[model samples]
Target: MTLAAGSLCLGGIVLFVVLAAGALLAFDEPGTANDGATFDAYVWRVARFTLLQASLSTALSIIFAIPVTRALARQLSFPGRVWVLRLMALPLGLPALVAALGLIGIWGRQGVLNSGLAWLGLAQPVSIYGLSGILIAHVFFNMPLAARLMLGGLERIPGEYWLVGTNLGMRPWSIFRFIEWPAICGLLPGIAGLIFMLCATSFTLVLTLGGGPAASTIEVAIYQALRFDFDPPRAIALSMLQITVTAVLLISIRMLTPKADEGHGSGRMVRRFDGRRGLGRAGDGLVIAIAVVFLVLPLASVVSSGLRSDLTKLVTDPLVQRAFLTSLVIAVVSGLFCVVATAAMIQARQTALASRHPTKPLRGLASGISASTSLVLLVPPVVLGAGWFLLLRPFGDVALFAPLLVILINMLMAMPFVYRVLEPAIATHSARTGRLAASLGLGGWNRLRFIDWPGLRKPFMMALSFACALSLGDLGAVALFGSQDMVTLPWLLYSRMGSYRSTDAAGLALFLGLICLMLTIAGTPAADRNDKRKPDAA
Candidate 1:
């Protein structure tokens, strides 16, 4: 049953790819998979803007995150410190539309800051549109994500290092240079790569804020081609280009970040050691405070508005009702598919491994490599969606599959995260019991019964709940296919925002946020209730 579901899920994604290929092949008869030549202007201009914005966004976010992470790294004894860390984490999980809304609330023309500026007799506040708005939203959502991930790295060095550095008479600058940097270096590639990927693939953020032609990214361009123009040929060509760009960057990212992404999920062991005293602390504190203000305040405002907004009318709309149902069905199906696909892929790797070597050491190495393939970790959501969409749409009306297709795309999109959660537990079980199971001559169903099921109860369940949470909040693939009759919760919220129905949008955002939060919280009980507490998957 599990394997069957897994096959169905992966099969659906494959089907989508095939459809895209068929579509492209049919549409572009003799045409190249380049939106170039005829649209030389769009090709160069979009590429230029995409690269420029991504490079600037990544650099600026990381730079600004440094001081913020430094201050937040100080273990606070006060109330709400933990909440502050969670606020940072929340952005990682926030649907893009939610973050975009928060940004607009503060930076929009009638926003608090702008309104205050006008009262102060300023000529005019700067526009929160085009490059400026995109940059602000990107930084607002991503900077904290980078900072928190980095903060976890800073806290992982053994406390003894601090004492040792002090004993060796190392000054704070020397301590940071010699001790902290080394400990955190292993994590930087992963964090930086992940951030770069997220920035590169930004979709809803760009769409919601890309005020004009000048600010459009590849994602927005693809959306325009399909949604506005319904030009399959141009969309397919654009998709191919986007994939090429993403794949090239990802190769570099992989070379830079092959290590497993693990530390951030675990609790940190924080310490007190400012690299400098006095003004340094103030500067660091200011950065951290700014991070909190930027990340948290927006969500708080969203929750407040999301709650206060009159929801009765929108919630009752047939379109909203149908979208909600479609989203729920898709999320459940995708989550189940993720669970099975993860299991099958893991099993395939193991099947290859066990047949090759019976030795524990060799098996360990193979398992490690196979597990790391889950490093689908580095592929961002939009990139994957674009690649598969380009590769599949030619054969059929992708709109026929629509929302369910979105769910399948999202599962493939989420494979890396689910695999990370399942890898270690699978490895441990194989290490301890593989030989014994072989000796018993266990086969197929029996193998899963005797070897896999017993050991995976907690982690598997945890993985499921999380997979559900991810699918529930997913916005990218759906962004491609979702329409008036086929929207998900995120798309519905986005539609509301575009129509300038702020109150309805807020209510929908609150609804979506609650659904995500509940599923995430439920995952804990599913994992923890087990008597077995396996180590976290890397």
Candidate 2:
């Protein structure tokens, strides 16, 4: 029964993709063929820009991350280290638009930096627009992610290795070469690939700061073709191209990354034996200071700027209230859907594993089901939303289904993360409880309540909360469906930004940030306590 339910959930995902892609192919206008000259040129331009920005963003994120990771790894017991780690998690839940605006608040032409420069009698040193702005935002988010991942790798290094380096009197650089570099090197390719894919598919950052055509990415191009041009054929073509690019990147990431569970660990607190010299400490301090400012100041701007906004006015506005309600409904519904689907998957895999004599076919089926959840990563939300729009257009009003469609997309989007969060916990619980349940002839609800519920409750709730937060902050699918009647919080916040209501946008950003932050906090206790995790990453 559990296997059947899980199979149905997997089938639902497959069915939606098939329907979306088939609809696009079916309804694509033949007229686009004659305009091939213009279309091809446009496609090539955006494609090149996407690759260029993604590659550069990936390189810069990893380059800066190495020093930051080195600093954090060696300086483990600082006064505010735990808070810095917490702040690193902020970007995961922070809406992209919020991050973008916060960045602008500090780095824009009339922003804090420029005002400070004016006071200091100096020229403005930088512009946060076009390619430079996009790069800055990408690095701001991804560098922390890379640093955390690398720091995890560094922490996992055995104490004996560091002790040996210390006894040999190895310098920081030499110790890094012999001890840290290998671990970092092993993770870098996967890190770079993930960052590259993120930048290539970035929509909110590109949409807000892309300045002009020269900076547009494939995602923004898809949005334009769908919303601005109303060109189904071009949109379909762009989506296909986007999928192709993402598929290649996903495959490359798989190949480059170590097959073992290489990330998302609550790393053990370990002592380091090196990098204690005054010069070394100074270098580490400098890198740590720069990274903190780069990441924290934008967020600080969000809080400070948001505090100045009339919160009562922004929150009480009818449109803002309606959008908030809509976003809440969608997030709750999507979170429920993801949790149910993920539970089904866990049950099915556990069933397979607990069988007395596991067969080849059963093993293959379980593996395939697990892999299917992650397949959503290859289809960016922009491409998926655009494809679905093409599917629904022939049926009359797509806006009528906008909320429902967004809910479904959000479920799919959150599945991979949900699986990542829950899988290890579920596996550990099942292994510990399986024999007892079987001995008592317990099954289904009895087994779940008596055996699984107590052990798995924290991770389950954590996964649900984070999944909801992810849905709350999403802009990609919502961008495709947003209308006056269909406004979500993200969509509403974006509308405010578009209309030059920066104060209102900041307020909305703060409200949205608080909601997501609460959800993330609700989940953290469980994650922190689950140190016995065995990686079952999807």
What does each candidate score in C-alpha RMSD?
5.3, 3.7
Q: Estimate each model's TM-score.
A: 0.83, 0.93
Please give the CA lDDT of all the candidate structures. 0.70, 0.84
lDDT per residue as tens, model 2, 64-125 = 99999898889866677777776776797788888998999998987898789888988756
User: On residues 1-538, what C-alpha lDDT tens digit does candidate 1 reach at each position?
Assistant: 4334434444554455555445454555454444455356786688788888888888788888766776766534434666677677777666777777777778888776788899999968867788888888888877887787777777666666666666788866787688656656676777776677677777878888888778888777877776677665566666666766777777777798756433332333434555446876666667767777777667786788887987787678887788778778888888888777777667655654656446765465445545434333333454445545555566686677676567766776666777888877787888998889889998678888867788887788778878887787777778877766677888888878889889888888888877777777666543345556322211
- Model 1 CA deviation exceeding 4 Å by range: 1-26, 29-36, 76-79, 258-285, 355-398, 432-455, 525-538
lDDT (C-alpha) at residue 188 in model 2: 83
